[model samples]
Target: MSLRFADGDFQSAWKELDEPQLDGGWELFTETMGVQIHRLYDEETGLYEYKVFGVLAACTPELCADVYMDLAYRKQWDGYVKELHEKDFDGQKAIYWEVKYPFPLSNRDYVYMRERQDLDMDGRKIWVILAKSSTVTPCMEKSGVLRVKDYKQSVALESDGGCGTKVFMNYFDNPGGMIPPWLVNWAAKSGVPGFLTDMQKACKGYANYCQKK
Candidate 1:
């Protein structure tokens, strides 16, 4: 991934970070797989804000963050990732990612830049990653794969006061084209929690492997 900033676009994203307003348009959608999910709509943008959070038992903030940032490792565990490849690496970072949609729907893809940091919050050390879709340069955005025009993701991870890790994710994206409302809801309610479950498992693997090393 290209790690360079242009025109301070990333700066603006950092400025917008804040604790979620629990009493906004958000509503408790569903809790499954031990994860709590809340969703809200952005009517003006025809998009939704999905916030899913849970604790990863036996995982550390570093392990959780590492699993997420490792694109090469994602191929092993990301069931929906059809292709995830780093396109370039300079001061700026970029990657090409393609997600497999269930049959009959065209696959979706994104070219995005992800930046991460370790910071202190309320006396707890946490890892934060900010990812935004980009079109910084001519990318190998495959033909026939639908491009995600608008996408933003924030991931925060901190120690769960002990051996485990606490994770919170806020994601907003427009998958483009028409999609059934039921499908969208299902994806958010189930997909979000399922992804977290998988991530928890991945972190466990990392923690175990690191212990052996």
Candidate 2:
């Protein structure tokens, strides 16, 4: 999917994210990017799926593992929590979670950061996983196959300034192909402004949350 961003806003957001104060707030950082949709309570299936795109700053393998474990246990954070299980994936440990949302919404199950091959060869992939419950419909529910989309991560250091990363997320789908090409283009074009605004608030909120912790 094509992502459109303001000339300098995307880059500016990256700089803001790099601040040293954000060290322990990995979950917040990821959510702030607005790349993933978090279904905290799917009443249909009675499950919750928390999703985000993550980039770890100055993180070690142990820290990464601890983060995942905390997420599984729903440690001290607010918003969403689930009972998590563990498994092995490509030799790395992965965490699985089962969440039961309040009734009326669909219940969705999630397999988070299910350790794929360390794509970057850096011992870990800076990403988060959110799943649609088996009971819930898939992206292409008509077919049995699950469609998995991987986000791209880019990190930049400004030398004289700070260092941070940006995640170029996938665009929303236009299944009908009936929407005018120009209209679709406009939506994609206009979407970035809203995305940037949401991201800024999220990032700042995360930074503050980390400070309190």
Candidate 3:
């Protein structure tokens, strides 16, 4: 499923994503193995607002919470790195940090507990969760192609298929007026194949780190 943002349509898309879908399976999976940050850039104030989400797999709720908290902290630190290393479109530089506590939007305290909640919500839940964290990284005049910026550059574990966790990573870029909706959708969809490949690599590294410790 792909969405396009036109003149007045952009705001409509934003409105369309108001309430979260609350998917049981995705919620379970995310509650088990996902972390995300939703950030917004205010050009007028020159400040950024950030919201974070994370889930960890563990036998006990306490352990899962602990791991999740640690992961959140790690993400905060990683965001610092991203800001430090981020390069602006004009080759200029800017730095910023989170302004609020990372909110927890789920009830599952552990991987086991998540099973109690419906993990088969027909996919609506995951969409809700994703919309909350999704960011629109607009295209830069200097960089003709849309690029995902401020990403933590990590990997993910997959269990749908394959023998082990498949790699996972995310990127977001807004093509702005430069690219039409059709082309933007086409380009965005076209990049998925290669993006997933790189994500797998990052996920593998993360899986290793998680296992080692």
TM-score of each: 0.84, 0.29, 0.26
Choose the strongest candidate by lDDT.
1
lDDT digits (tens) for residues 36-90 of candidate 2:
3222333543322222233433333233333433442233342233445664545
User: Can you write out model 1's per-residue Cα lDDT over 87-131, one digit (the tens) per residue?
Assistant: 754455577899998878889998888888777646657687888
Which candidate would rank higher by lDDT, 1 or 2? Answer: 1
* Best candidate according to TM-score: 1
Give per-residue lDDT, candidate 3, residue 80: 19
Task: Please identify which of the two predictions, 1 or 3, would achieve the higher lDDT against the true structure.
Answer: 1
Off by over 4 Å in 1: 1-19, 89-92, 207-213
Quantify all predictions' global Cα lDDT against the true fold.
0.76, 0.33, 0.28
The count of residue-pair clashes in candidate 1 stands at 11
Error of 2 at 124 (Å): 14
Task: Tell me the spans in candidate 2 whose CA falls farther than 4 Å from its real position.
Answer: 1-75, 87-94, 100-102, 111-113, 116-163, 169-213
Location of the lowest summed lDDT over 10 successive residues in candidate 2: 129-138
What is the Cα-based TM-score of model 1? 0.84
| RMSD of candidate 2 to true structure, Å | 14.3
Sorted by lDDT (best first), the order is: 1, 2, 3
